[model samples]
Target: MAAGQVDELRKRVNDDWERIVELLKQKIALGSVSSKGIAADHMKRSAQFVADELIKVGVDAKVVQSTNPDGSAGAWEVIGSKIVNEQAPTVLLYAHHDVQPVPDASQWDTDPFVGTEIDGRLYGRGSADDGGGIAIHSGALQALGDDLPVNIKVFIEGEEEMGSPSFIPFIESHREEFDSDVIIVADSGNWSADIPSLTTSLRGNTTLDVTVSVLGHPVHSGQFGGPILDANTLAAMLISSLYDEHGDVIVPGVASQEVVGGLQRDLDEASVRADAAVEPTYTMAGTGSLAERLWTKPSITVIGMDVHPVEGSFNVIANQTRIRLSMRTAPGQKPQEAQQALAKYLVENAPFGAKVEVTPLDNGMGWAMDPDAEATQDALQAMKEAFGVDPVNKGEGGSIPFIPELQRIFPQAQVLVTGPEDPKANAHSPNESISLSGLRNNVIAEALLLSKLGGE
Candidate 1:
């Protein structure tokens, strides 16, 4: 592909910006949220919608169902094309159809499910996080006139927000169908607004729940004040020990890496007070880059603490209490191993006379992409042509567990993680949105990238 051809594709993308946004908004309004029990129906419907769109673009699209199905539990698959090109390497374009559940409508300026436009953004539940990305890639293919120079496939998932439990199993069963030389994941954001970024790393995550039970029953506080055991108090102590006074994770065995410069958060004294909800933001006490602490260090957060509360002013000692903890592990450490470390710390470090039970709920491994791969270089060049700025290399704190799976499956495939959204895109937050300018520029970038790689 010559430079002139890439420039022409970029111009074509800019010309089709409005149509892309409309397609995105229409998809977001569908409200596809998949969970363990109620995933199949919504997934099937979402797949149908994608198939229809692909067919409209003159691509031969079909819903490839999963072999294992439990009596209409909702079959999941992709609506895609295999642009047979023996001259070019195969590539897979990926996205997710499912979204996170919406918040109460009263909390937003407009309906959370409705794609509302405000201040140059389209606000909705899945607008920026994923729905917008899906639209951009689909539109890129449409603008390319259905005669792609390489074999292309779009693999969208319904379980992305729900930890992708069925993702690997599905992939394993359909491995031959989804094979590609490059995997392009557009579900992430730029480092900040107006700055395109290629996400080079993503920290994995694991979830564990701890419960402390004592005395087997709620005892009278006044009558047994001297010897009565408090499950709530013991659970609190177990959680508090997860971090040292400096807020650094005290658990051993987890990995940590050096951080890159310019990525640390510098909070003023006032900002610290407001954020920590106290007088000061507790420092980690150790010196390293903030990205090291954020992306490459072990972090334990108490997601929920259950305790017997006073609604009618009860004076009883509670016998049972529990709390959920989410531990974020670095790229090299296994999520399962980290969860075990957390469980061991909670069990051995609990207070005396308290029985602690630590249970792991879920886990997934972290991912790190090669920064110097062909896909990364091509994406940078495409973004520079579209946005007129060199893209930055970035690391994300969140995990896209499937990236590691893709790497393991296709060791030769180059992976790229650049997308249209930015820091303030509000993905997974109330009134989530995507910027029009960013989306337009990303369409141009992705189109250029396809032209660059899918050339004869």
Candidate 2:
């Protein structure tokens, strides 16, 4: 915990940069998508890979298997522990090893599964989403060597990207194994490439699959174009009705909350356009500050649709259309409440007397924590000391469904969400990457956090 010790730890992490990249590349090459059969096997290997790395740092590590909610084999969960002092407070470090499937490799600048470094940034599918997280934990522990200050528990999950279908049962079945005083989720993003951030809140999510039927079978467009309504057209109208001209959700019962005053980053029109790849001439939608719309309000997106391809020149009226709807709720909104509101709107607003059926797909609750808590103060101080700048408190628009669950399981534990992702990281998208400097700073901050929380 001395200045020289901190300097040495930073030096060690910097020296091991290549090794960290190699380990990340190895995991990226495994293709651990839970939906694929081979992904299960790859995930097991990924878990063991983490365990082995932890063991190299003198930690007791092992791979544990559990069943998915549907009674199928689930991805392996790795648990590594280093008990420097049993009396010290336990620190749990959390990260996921699984990567999302490459939807279309053609869209990427490089192979999505191959970790590539260009201009000091490592790029790949999982390179930033969580592969960086895995490396951060390993790098921090490795830097500590035999001088680790606290009882450390490292948890690497394999099914986070897949919505953690097995997480509830897995945690319930092994509650004691994950007991800790503080939990740090290394799966969020920094405010920017140079500005570190601590995520204070995460939005919850709900999804619905809707099917609309207007006719018994396909009919010639010319014969029934005016008199008979097509399911596809009706589906389009129904989806459009979910939003008003301002691009805000029109559902009546969904909730919204005001973000507390703080040093929030202003997401301007230019930044939004660049980040979203929007057309330069397009005008921004919604009726609030960009930050308010993005971080403190409900948003709806049409994720997928099942309809005839336009390339085939289908002039026939389709009998049915299926659509997938994904909605992100405000922090204080419950997923169930949002789901019901969405379902009610879709059902009541169906056009052309179409027969509609709405099926609930999944739901994840939002999470919020006090930024001034004792552990959070320690984290902020550590980050400031390590990065030489004040860390910003931010709210994530995306959902980490299991975070609230972890809070519920360990009500007394302080949750700290921090990571290496920046706006340009583009996690779960093509050309995902991470800044090497950011990774190094993350390792330093985490190491210092562990030391400080250990009462050093």
Candidate 3:
């Protein structure tokens, strides 16, 4: 593959940018929220949509069924392949079709299900987190056409947002279908919009639902307010115990490995504050470098709570309070160990003699890659060529769970984690978006990588 040929392919991808955006908009509108079973139908439709697009681009595509952990039906996994050179190494391209639920739609600038362009960015749920990823795969293939140098395998996951509970089993059940020499997980973000990034490590994750009960039934607050222990108060107290005064995780036995000389790109505190909409008076928490705290340290968060709204004004002692706890384990930490630590912490620290119950929801191990691997070097070069700038190397605080699963299944395969998201992309949050130019550049990079890997 000559440099001139790669340039030509990149130009073709740029020329087809509008079509790619349109295809992405169609996917975003499907509302394929995997956590909500009611959206299963739409998720299947989304998978089929991806298959159809791949077919249109001359790839053989199909939708495969997956079984959920609870023995219930799961979303469809779209598998597409194009074997241009049988002797070349196969590259598996991965992204998810399912998206996070729009909890409070009112927070979005535009309709959460509608892809709206504002200031050179596309705003909508899944726009950057993964919809842009799907577009990148399709656009890259379309740009290469039948002249693709690699044997390509496309795996658009169906339930990544739901922690990919069915992924391991699904992959195990059809090992041959997922066989590849290299895997590119397009579900991470860049260091900044101007600086492209290659994700070298991912945090592990585990989740549990905790409930505290102090009373069998609600009682009038006026009569019991002085002595009664409301479930809400007990829950809050137990949750508070998991954090120290400095906001660092105080959970016992969770591993925190030091990240020594992998990717030294520290997140800019001011940019993080601005992107998160933090007030100017707010102080950052935890000890150590921002990168260390974010990528190599354990963290706990209360993702959701089941409590009565203040607007209702019941004025009663609540009988029970339920909260969903998400714990992010640092690389080299096992998620099950973290889950056990969290469960033990919650049970032993129940406040005011309140009964506490903790149920483990999901667990996934974290993964770290050798930055000096041959495939990684090739990918770095490809990204540099595509973006016309040196790409930064970084570690993600968030867990992709399945990345480790893929590494386990294909120990010999090199996994390349890259994506179109940036800090300002706001993935899994309100007003999520992707920069149009960033998406285009990512497609070009991926195309160039495939070409380079095939040549190798």
Candidate 4:
């Protein structure tokens, strides 16, 4: 197909941009925060709105009960419509309707639940991270009307912010309904506002809790200071030792590999940090591209330390302490293997004679995509056609545990991650927002992808 054909479609998408944003805001206002996500009940309502919209656009939509987790009585709906074309491969366009918890409401300028637009940007919790992308895909489907030529399926989740714990099982139980030639996870964002990116890999995550008990009771620091071990200090020292001076995770058995396309990741890191409002910290010593350091390597962070501080002039020594360790593993790494390694590391590295216990909290697998697949190329070309610019190929530092599991089960399906989100989307932060321009571009791109795939 000639690029002009795609370009025309792109123009049509641009024409409908305002309407798209309106629909997007309407969707965002529904508030579908995941478990521990920003707006739990609101998220459910937003998802229902999305289901309703999909049906209006000629897509067959239905809600699927998340059968994986017991006692979590919620449903995730699957919206789909087949493009009647023989040549194109079936593609599944995916997004999550969930938003993170909007804590510290006082810090936000506008209501986090209300979709607000200012200076050409749409501000809302889910606007950029996912709601924007979902809007784009929905807009594309709407623009195509009944002219679609390939099968397209939309898998929107309400549990992504909560690690998508229920989604993997939902996919497993409903595998037959989701059979597709390609899968597009439009949950991530671009490396920068200026650079569109095709995410190729995502790190996996594991959480561990370490509890320490030194004595039976809190003793006066001045009276019993001589002989008792300080559980807090010991815990701090053990946690501190998890990283080396070079910032490398020194845990034994936690494997490391050089990431691919490292240069882009360095750029991404700088961009991500700037957008995330991070203060400059010492850079770690690592050899390889930023992608390797981010996607292909292991990262350990002390998530939390539960310890009584010496506040209010307290002169007592606390008897127990606990810490939360969050570990992100590279793609192709086993969560159990990493968990075991962490357990062993803590056991061996702990302070002598202290009662130490390590417990695994959550284990989610890593994901790696086949970057050389045809669907990937088709999507890339479609992006170029829509934006008139080559998109960046990169990987995310965080993990979407469900992606790898989906790939493992549907090895034949092509997985692609592209979306309208950006660093400022504040996916897990306060005052989350999405760009109207970016949303327009994404809608065109998805429509172009649909066109290109249909023509094939």
Candidate 5:
């Protein structure tokens, strides 16, 4: 395709940006929080709204009730497809309609459901995490009209915020419709607002529950505290053994690798601290550049621990305590292997002869995109043209967990991880938002990519 064709696609997107934002705002207002706590009917409303909007743009769309793990009905997901020609390549565009629960509405500057535009950012629960991705797909389809270069398949899951429990079954049931040459997952963010990114790698996750038993029965802290420690204290010691003084995962068996791209120079230590809201008084943990620490290194956190409530304090030390460890493995590492290693480490490192039991929770594999894939190159060129800057190769410290499933089902398809998010998007947090320019450019980029794939 000629550069002029891409320019025309950009122009078309710019013209449709306002309408796209309005539709996105309406979708955001539906407040499709995931089924973790919100009602299923609420998610269905958002799914149905997206289906209606896509149908209006001439795409065949529908709201589907996902099948739960136990064969029960689950949350609603939307799947839509528009095929121009069988000979043309098929591209599956993926997003999520669900938003994280607004556990505390008081933390938000604006209503979580109402899209509030301020200084070029649209702030709301789903605005950046995925509402913007939906807008890009809808706007691109509208701009392309009947002149599409490739078949478009849209997959919007309603439970991504909760780790997409039913994602594999949902896509497996509709395998034929989703059989595509490429997948554009719009769930990640860019390196920065000025630099567009194609996320090439994501860390995998595995969980382990460590329980410590220091005594057969409760003991008086005042009498036995000098010679014996409580299970809670022993549990803390076991957790601390997983990390070094510098907060690095020092476990011998867990592996780490250097990323394809070195540290992202666009982000400095200060910027990262700011993004994570780390206090200035605290020191950045681990070693290497910020990108390496985040993207390639393994990290372990004691997400939860069971202990006696401070308000209901007891003079006696508890016999047993449990702590949940959530570990993020590097891309290309086997999560099961790491989990085993973690289990062994906790058992060996138990302090004061405390009996330790490690139980496996779950292991979700990570994804590493092939940068040399044709679809990937097409996306990079499209993003460069649309954003007027060279695109960056990015890695996500967080794991999608479901992307690998998509690959397992369609081994030949190239996955292009693209999104409209930036550092300040604040996805899953209070005041979540997406930059308007970023959203507009993302729409243009997708249109450009489709044109490239279709050889327009």
Candidate 6:
């Protein structure tokens, strides 16, 4: 509200730093790994944990789940609200309680479920991905006490890591509980530990499954290899066709362009390489500024394929093969259209007339923030005050599919994306972490933003 009140809010956040970190540690230990398949016990417990914290901050919180198209109750979610004034504008704070699956905990430097702090960073599976986000919301609410100037709704999703398959249904099932004028998505990252950022754009994604077939049955490689190439080789050729000599995508109808906006600050090459752990010798893909190549332009990656394991392989000519390609589409392009272009290319350019079958796996839309919106401007200014430096507009290469869905359902809502992650967060990786500074700053920024939205 007032300058003095803002200072008091930040001081309160700093005072509660240890309490917030401890809460995050407890959340990490819950290990609510979200996927299409898993026991619901862990997720249910995770939602309760979040509800307990929000209740302490005066939110009326509860655990919920909605039925899917199959008439089955889907993933668990936590929804809460604190209405100080009904007439005041409402703000919805969003984050996920579920962490990514840890198929191999041995790869982590510490126990994947045990939150560990080292060199001012908290390391754990979901600490950066979204546990940090929960901490920010809880800590900020705790600081605001009963002085909140606006109504607030807290949404902790249980299936965000699974592309939010149950998210839209969850919101639609309880429209009144989730509706808000401003939605703050704490699921992305800052530009750096010292530089706060508001995520402004995201590249959408689509996947395809290409099946190449040559013969009806497997044949001896030594006896029938010359007549036609094996299915794996033919599949490889089709995969290669998606790229050109310089690694730029050549898929027809897929656009490749760079971001031209006020917030696009060119990235420093060395820093990005270090943060992404990109080897110096790896050939840079595409032709454009590194930032655009990552945030706006199209890129194709062979994520998976069905092939015989070298350890248990037989010397035979495979008759059929299936390959999965993950294509990152440009921000403004339609993912379904991109999927179509990819399927067409694979089907028409089959190697040696090999029978090809293309399957559309999945698709998600991208987003570009409207910088002129009142709430968007508020978030940027709040971040500047919290971090003591002007906040930068950032673009994310990854797609949070649920984001566009939120816009589709609530076109009037202003969505502002910001979070506690920095480049080194390593979210979804073995050594995931979040900087304590980012966590604290994000808490302060969110609290300030809520105050401003309430017309403080």
- Which regions of candidate 1 deviate over 4 angstroms? 1-3, 29-45, 67-72, 111-116, 213-229, 259-287, 312-320, 352-354, 454-456
* C-alpha lDDT of residue 149 in model 1: 69
Model 3 misplaced stretches (Cα beyond 4 Å): 35-41, 103-106, 207-252, 279-282, 302-326, 339-361
Give the TM-score of each candidate: 0.84, 0.85, 0.81, 0.87, 0.92, 0.89
Question: Considering only N, C-alpha and C atoms within 3 Å, which residue pairs clash in candidate 3?
Answer: none
Every candidate's lDDT: 0.74, 0.84, 0.86, 0.75, 0.85, 0.87
Model 3 Cα lDDT, one tens digit per residue, 139-239: 98899887788888888999888777788888888778789999999988777776778887888989999999999999999998978878988899998
Please give me the total number of clashing residue pairs in predicted model 4: 13
Please provide, for model 4 over 1-456, each residue's C-alpha lDDT reduced to its tens digit, 9 standing for 90 to 100.
476666667767777777788777887677666654323455556667877877877777765546446656655555565556545668788887776777687788888878898887888877887787778778898777666778877787766777665676677777876878888888887765665778877788899999988889888888887687678888888877888876778888897765543344355566646755677884645556656776788988888988765575477777899989899987778978998998988887777667889998888888776666677788778777666778877777887777887788889888888877776676667788887777777787788777776763
Q: Provide the RMSD of all predictions against the true structure, rounded to 1 decimal.
A: 3.8, 3.5, 4.4, 3.3, 2.3, 2.9
Clash totals, every prediction: 1, 0, 0, 13, 0, 0
What TM-score does structure 5 among the candidates reach? 0.92
Candidate 5 has which clashing residue pairs, if any?
none
Candidates 1 and 3 compared: the better one by TM-score is 1
Better of 1 and 6 by lDDT: 6
lDDT pick, better of 1 and 2: 2
Please give, for residues 1-456, the per-residue lDDT of candidate 2 as tens digits. Answer: 577867877888888877887988887887777656423666788788888987887779999987877787777898878888888899898998888888899999998888888998888888998988988888888877777788888788888887788888988887777899999999998887777888878889999999999988899999889888889889989988878988887889998876633545666678878878998778777778777777778888889999878788678989999999899998888999999998988888889778999999999898877767888888888888778788877887888889999998899999999987998898888898999788889888888888789786
Candidate 2: the clashing residue pairs are: none
Q: Which candidate is the best by lDDT?
A: 6
- Cα lDDT over the full model 4: 0.75
Candidate 6: residue 50 lDDT (0-100): 93
Looking at model 3, residue 229 earns an lDDT score of 76
Clashing pairs in 6: none
lDDT (Cα, tens digit) per residue for candidate 6, span 1-456: 466877898899988988999999999999888773432887888889999988988899998875665667787889999998889999999998988989898899999899999999999989988999999899988888888888999899888887676678778778898889999999898988888999888999999888899999999999887887999999988888888898888989998655735635788888878876898898677677888888888888889889899998998999999988898898888999999988998899999999999889889998878878888878888898889898877788888888988988888899889898998898888899999988998999999998888877
| lDDT per residue as tens, model 5, 1-456 | 577777778788778777899998998898887845423677778889999989977789998888878887776888989988989999999988888778998999999889999998999988988898889889988888888889988888888888777889889999987999999998887777778899978999999898899888999999888778889888888787778888888998999988755544534777777767898789888877778788878999889999989997979988999899999998888899999999998898889778999999999898888867778888889889888999887788888888988998999999888887898988878999999988888888888888888876
